[model samples]
Target: MKSAKQRFAGRYRAPGPKRSPLITPEGAAALKAELDDLWRNKRPVITQAVGEAAALGDRSENAEYIYGKKMLREMDSRILYLQRRLDRIKVVEGTPADPNRVYFGAWVTLVDDDDNERCYRIVGADELNPSSGFISIDSPLALALIGKQLDDRVELSDLDKGYEIIAIDYKSAAAE
Candidate 1:
């Protein structure tokens, strides 16, 4: 009988917190392209390398063969995850009906009580990038910003912070 690892080929991953299924068009495209590249290009090259290593001699002691197999298992797991994620996620596009109020994909500017301004774009969980100022809609800050309009005062009780909406737009831009 094969061990669980051998039977699954290392494809099994422990369940994680359920991520929100909303993704921007660009985020969806990026994920799809990664899936295609792994399945079509990278996997085939690694498979060939493993085959060559296997043909050379005993695979159990062959370092190249072992490494290639390990890489293959990891890539296969990611491929499976991408396939399932793409199928279930909803791709959000276009500006919201009410652009004045913050919504998914909205770039909002807020000034803290100390008069420091910050800008962030509300995106899905898969698209969160702090450096790029893209925050997940599930985040506390984004949650508070949603449904708010320009000049609206927002308060975060947990952090004892308060901010006022300075600007709101569907497109990312510098704070006004």
Candidate 2:
């Protein structure tokens, strides 16, 4: 009994491609720490708050109780997502076999035609921070950079730009 519009919408909304389950060691550790904090600390605190709010008055009109319940649900949902993500992710340790080429966890330096230099670290999707120069491995730029060596030109047709690989280092740039 669905309308044509509804059927068209459902047919057009295809799922996105599956993301790779590879994660850097640091990224994995961060996720684990967050999951632990949620389960051991935040969850208990919210549960207690919800209990206290429920005891205060009638459930129907209780704003505090409703808010607490909503917060608890959000927290639980995030915890579940983290648990599942952690279970499937494979932590990539050390460096790539070919350190001279761009790969996951590599700090890459690129130069544009205008002589502008940019640096980025290819990392897991969960750890991407554009402002911090961390790019997800699934990103188009990272995909283009992968396996490319020094002095190699990478064409990004979508962005209408190209970059030359200037340097590739596996060491953590943040430490330096």
Score each candidate by Cα lDDT. Answer: 0.89, 0.90
- Give per-residue CA lDDT, model 1, range 86-114, as digits (tens): 99989888888888998888888889989
Quote each prediction's TM-score. 0.85, 0.90
Q: After superposing candidate 2 on the true structure, give the runs of residues whose Cα lies further than 4 Å from its correct spot.
A: 1-16, 173-176
The digit string of per-residue lDDT tens for model 2 on 80-175 reads 999999999998888777888888889999999899999999989999999999999999999999999999999999989999999888877434
In model 1, the runs with Cα more than 4 Å from the true position are 1-15, 172-176
> Candidate 2's error at 57, in angstroms?
2.4
